[model samples]
Target: MFLGMAVFLVGCAKGGSSLNTVPVKGRVTLDGAPLPGATVTFSPKTPEGRTAAGMTNENGEFVLTTIRAGDGAVPGEYGVAITKPVATAGPVDDPRARGGALTPEQMAQIREQAKTKGGAEGGSAIPKKYTSPTTSGLTATVKRGEKNEFTFDLKSQ
Candidate 1:
């Protein structure tokens, strides 16, 4: 009885946290122009694993990866957020240049600072609403056996 109970508990512990990811890719454009170097994120509407994200290349193309590079995300509906902050100021101190590796939290803070006070003397090319999943009005459904390609055409005005 004791061994059976132990096995049951172990099975329960390993039951639900498996990652079943699907490939997701997309393009982002603003005012008909490619928005390069933008950060695109997919936050699962229900409780999934960690969020998946990708950075757009120069052609404004991105591929989503959650656990491993290019490994993709779990199948689900996601709320999307995109942010691209173009710097308007001159050279500023970067933590990386000082040989200190910045944590994700620190990197996020830097991005926020740039959005609020960096671009063109504190201006942003992309609308602020697109920076948050709650406000971006972007959604995508990643299906199990479907090509999850999406396009987001944004307006600066």
Candidate 2:
């Protein structure tokens, strides 16, 4: 009886099975700078392929777990679509005057930096796509059980 129970536990573990799923992890950077909080939508190469997707973290890093459906990204080509970053609004000072610092010039400088970084109202610093050159080096083909690294370089259109 004990032997049978042990065998059942081992079967449950399912070790050494190729079906054991691993994750695809990497960071998204632009001009050698981290693009934190960027939305990375990865659609499978085909309806028969495994569908997995995730969003980048504050470090512009993301991990997509393989679904049990079709083979994870068939060992072939793939298309990557990285949406333009949406800038986040900085913390606004309360009108209640809880702050005890920050001169008028300093505040102005802060606003200016934010605007230069993205926009006064916070917008994408890069265009949605390279309207001219299609070779933007934005796509990548992930290998099975392998972690792929992808870097994107952007310039003003």
Candidate 3:
């Protein structure tokens, strides 16, 4: 009976999940409106911490997933960085886009055009500073056994 109980207990313990992540959810807004399709990242402030990430829906709502789908994150201090990549219209009229053989001079011109197309700013909808952890000016503290909801408001200007 003692041997049977030990085996049963070990089986029960092994069958359970080892990870203990907390529920973390949040919403993102730009200038007081829902910012859809924006990616939200939570970087651990500590060296031995795990990061969590999620993307906003049409209503700017998001559910963080650390391990599995909607599994949430491990409780800790995190630096948040939100970003939205702007879509650029393809160079429809550019001959390089077509399946045509180009001369050496044409290739050089095409490279020059690509270099000057977006300029230095690159095309993010939000300020470039907000895309990095150190410059974003956002932070959060995820706790255990409680509501870990957060809301971030961003400005265009």
Candidate 4:
């Protein structure tokens, strides 16, 4: 009975090890400077599998991982999106802060207030296009058994 259990466990381990993944790492730079605290996402182009994502550290370095930490990503072409929101100076009121659905009038009032308060103050530092995978114009092909390292030079303008 012990032998059978051991064989089953080994089989399970082997099955788990069969998942295909490849290492992906990269650096992000905005206007020639390292961009920290930015989120980098890799959405598979062909629906081949799950998406892989990572956040840039202080040095603007990141490693793609999916399913498991640092396990890398499935080999395929992917659309990349990178974003970093600017910091706000003070707290802003949220329409749903009361813990219920907001009425249309309340939403309009908040929008008007935000416009008057300067909506761009706490907006994203990265270009709006770069925040969407479809519009970022960034693509990477993760090849199997190969080191997939990339450097993204983004422009704020």
CA lDDT, every prediction?
0.71, 0.46, 0.68, 0.69
lDDT of 3 by residue, 1-157 (tens): 9999999888765431444778888999999999986667777889866666666777998777655556677889988877665756542242222323334454343323222323124466777666766677888899998899999999888
Model 1 Cα shift for residue 82 (angstroms):
0.1
Tell me the tens digit of each residue's lDDT in model 4 across 62-148. Answer: 876664555677889887878665767654343222223334454343333222322244777788777767778898999997879
Q: Compare the candidates by lDDT and give the number of the best one.
A: 1
Q: Locate the minimum summed-lDDT window of 10 residues in model 2.
A: 94-103
Native-to-model Cα distance after best TM-score fit, residue 98 in candidate 2, in Å = 29
lDDT of 1 by residue, 22-99 (tens): 888899999999998776777778974447777777789888766556666788888788876656666444333333
Best by TM-score: 1
lDDT of 2 by residue, 6-105 (tens): 9988886653244444445567776767766444434445554433444455677765434322213333344554544454765444211221333445
Report the CA-based lDDT of candidate 3 relative to the real structure: 0.68
User: What are the models' TM-scores?
Assistant: 0.69, 0.47, 0.68, 0.68
Clashing pairs in 4: none
lDDT of 4: 0.69
